[model samples]
Target: MKLPKRPKQHILETASYKLFSSKIPDEWIIRDITERDYGIDCYLEMVNDDNELSGDLALIQLKSKDEIEWTNKDTFTHYGVDISTTNYWYQFPIPVFIFIGDISNQKLYFNSVHYTIKRNFDQFVKQTTFPYKFKKSDLFEGKDGVFAFKFHYYYEKYRQQFENELRFFISNLQHYKDFQQLHNNLDYHLGLEDTDQIFFESMHKNFSFLCTYFNIDNPIPKLRDIKKKSREKFGNESHYELYEHDLTEWMEEYEKLTINLIVGMKSFLNGELPYWLRINPTIYNYVNNIGDDGTLPYE
Candidate 1:
């Protein structure tokens, strides 16, 4: 009797799966569905530390390479594929992440396939076997549950209905209470921290729409500048050391600006949110109507 033989393809793919399994939190579950023969190789479901399913899920398309190199210096990683395959990936209801593992050094690089379509659809459609670039920053850092949290955030956004965009916009503005607390607490800014960098990024992620909502100058940059200086002096050694840079001139102004933003947020939270929900046109009206009806048509 003859026995079945394993091909090089099987060994390579199995190695890739093993690498991915190691990076994820042990609490998470990876269901291998490669036999299904669709584009997806696995369904990754996250389990929260509380030992319960977090209901966070994503589709994975795994590709393996040894010693992955950046296509353009360290800017980004580009992978080429036929337009039809991208067209196929775009149809998924949920997010599809193209996870490329560098088996040699044990690093994983990933980017959302749909994100490519959404960002460069026009040019993308015009070509075939296009090299889609993925952000270098998105490479797995191998620690901190940041990737898991970010996965859920993007997945949640994908599941939201188009009608919820405005509500999301309002929601982003209504929630600065946590930051406001830090703004008032002077001791917290003694040194630079990861959260400080994240704050600057998160605060300004929606800045284009934010400009329409809040007209104040962005204070995040100044704080981030302070953070950089602290990093220069102290490195990531600690988050509580005294900053060499003086905070006297900007602290109060920064607090006041933050408070004003809070005030604006409150105004929108109490005012626009309800209006957006039910849309009482009168509250948003600028024209005044007179019972006499005999004057100029406009206010």
Candidate 2:
């Protein structure tokens, strides 16, 4: 009499969960879906450095294999995506990750659905079945640090409109230095000229794009005080030196703000920073406008 036995696929599925979960850092929570899973298996919610729960989440689909090839010399596929599953991925508000675990070696690999589609839109959309071929660089088991940077880099693209032109902006700032040789040398971007225009424009574009992408309800913060301080010079007009001084100071503040915000946002998704602190919204957010007296407006 043949006895009923657990299928090999079932055994591999359990092993895959164990293998993948073991690789994930303990601080991150893996929440299994309560509803029937058409595609996504679980969400990986991050735990910040303060030992607090960060509400940021990324959807994850987990798969297991007895053995997974890290490289593909032949025309074999690592995974396949069909129309129904592709549509489900597009519906997600945040990035979706697909993690395939090698149960045999207890190793893991990952692919970002968002990044993939962004780089290969035509192939992704036109194919009836998108065959995913894994490159050796797709390995994720020992590269969580790299993942932190990638998460921060691509997070904005998810919310951006199809016609968004933020990527067109470039940066090449000039500084006001005290070297005698450098002072006399004349470049077209002379005496912080590049920075004066570029910095202002960059800041404006960055803030505007951020507000539109994030759907901020309030207006951006003003540099009214900074602008006011510049006009108090001896001639009742500002010189290049004043602009240089103010720009340098503001750039330092902006640098700190950029680093801190990147840490908070990047750290939230991937838990890279050990002391990931939550940023206050008021530090970056602003009211629609202040009162005529320039005092805080009423809510």
- Most TM-score-accurate candidate: 2
Show model 2 residue runs off by greater than 4 Å.
72-76, 142-244, 248-299
Q: What lDDT does each candidate get?
A: 0.56, 0.52
Candidate 2, after superposition: displacement of residue 270 in Å?
Answer: 27
Report the C-alpha lDDT of model 1 over 36-128, residue by residue, as the tens digit.
Answer: 456688988866659798776778878877766776656554555667767777777777777777788887767777655544545565656
Query: Model 2 misses residue 14 by how many Å?
Result: 1.1
Which residue pairs come into collision in candidate 1?
Answer: none
Considering summed lDDT, which 10 consecutive residues are worst modelled in model 2?
A: 169-178
Compared with the true structure, the alpha-carbon lDDT of candidate 2 equals 0.52
lDDT of 2 by residue, 36-78 (tens): 3577888877766686895767787777778875434622255
Query: Residue 218, candidate 1: how far off, in angstroms?
Result: 14
lDDT of 2 at 236: 43
